[model samples]
Target: MLRIAGILLAGTGAAHFAAPQVFDPISKAAFPDDTRQWTYRNGAIEVALGLALTTKKTRLLGLAGTAGYAGWLASRVRANRGASQ
Candidate 1:
């Protein structure tokens, strides 16, 4: 289960780096030109956390990764309010 989740994270992170423009219009505050850099940084973090989640020696990293993912999702929801809000 952990490995699957990790792979999902890494895959999405790769997509972010490879096609950041797909994510650009969702932002509420970031400048247009800075989006790709932001995407790449996020991709790096996701890849790192995903890698960290792959072993018992670093199991604690899974907790941190979960927290980070939760926070990231919450932020996206908050920042992209529309008729649902």
Candidate 2:
């Protein structure tokens, strides 16, 4: 289960680089013309976290990181709604 989730996370991260335009809207919401750089940075983080998730020794740490990442995402949603969390 962890491996599958890791692969999906990594794959989406790779896609951020491969088909970045698809993610441009999300990036653009936060950045202006320089969105790709941020996208790449986020992609790299996702890839690293995903890789960590795939390794048994790092799985717990990865879970923690992922949870934090998720919190970041949730913040985005809150920001979009102009709501506090």
Candidate 3:
């Protein structure tokens, strides 16, 4: 059960990170002229962390990465909304 949870969490995190590139057309249409390198970096890091989560030895790292990513994502969402208004 724990392992399954870990896999699910890791996969979701990875998807969040890759969202921009995976959905490039949508992103470009929504946010024209926004070409940030950090998005790709985030995706790469998330993929690495997700792979790490699959191993017992790196579970802690994976959890930490997920928590950090979630916090960062929340902050970004809040900041974007604040700016739009």
The model with the greatest lDDT is 2
Tens-digit per-residue lDDT, 9-41, candidate 3: 557546756566664443333223353454455
Q: Superposing all C-alpha atoms, what RMSD in Å does each candidate have to the true structure?
A: 4.1, 3.8, 4.8
Task: Candidate 3: give the clashing pairs.
Answer: none
TM-score, per-candidate, Cα-based? 0.66, 0.80, 0.57
How high a TM-score does candidate 3 get?
Answer: 0.57
lDDT of 1: 0.67
| 1-85: candidate 1 lDDT, tens digit per residue | 8877777877877777778777555432333345567667777777777777777777587768769876885776566556232
Q: In candidate 3, where is summed lDDT lowest over 10 consecutive residues?
A: 24-33
**Model 2 scores what on Cα lDDT?**
0.80
Q: Rate the local accuracy (lDDT) of all candidates.
A: 0.67, 0.80, 0.60
Tell me the spans in candidate 3 whose CA falls farther than 4 Å from its real position.
1-21, 24-36, 82-85
Q: What is the lDDT of residue 27 in candidate 1?
A: 36
Candidate 2 per-residue lDDT over residues 1-85, each given as its tens digit = 9988998898888899999988876765544546788788778888988988998999999999999987886666556552221
Worst 10 residues of 1 by lDDT: 24-33
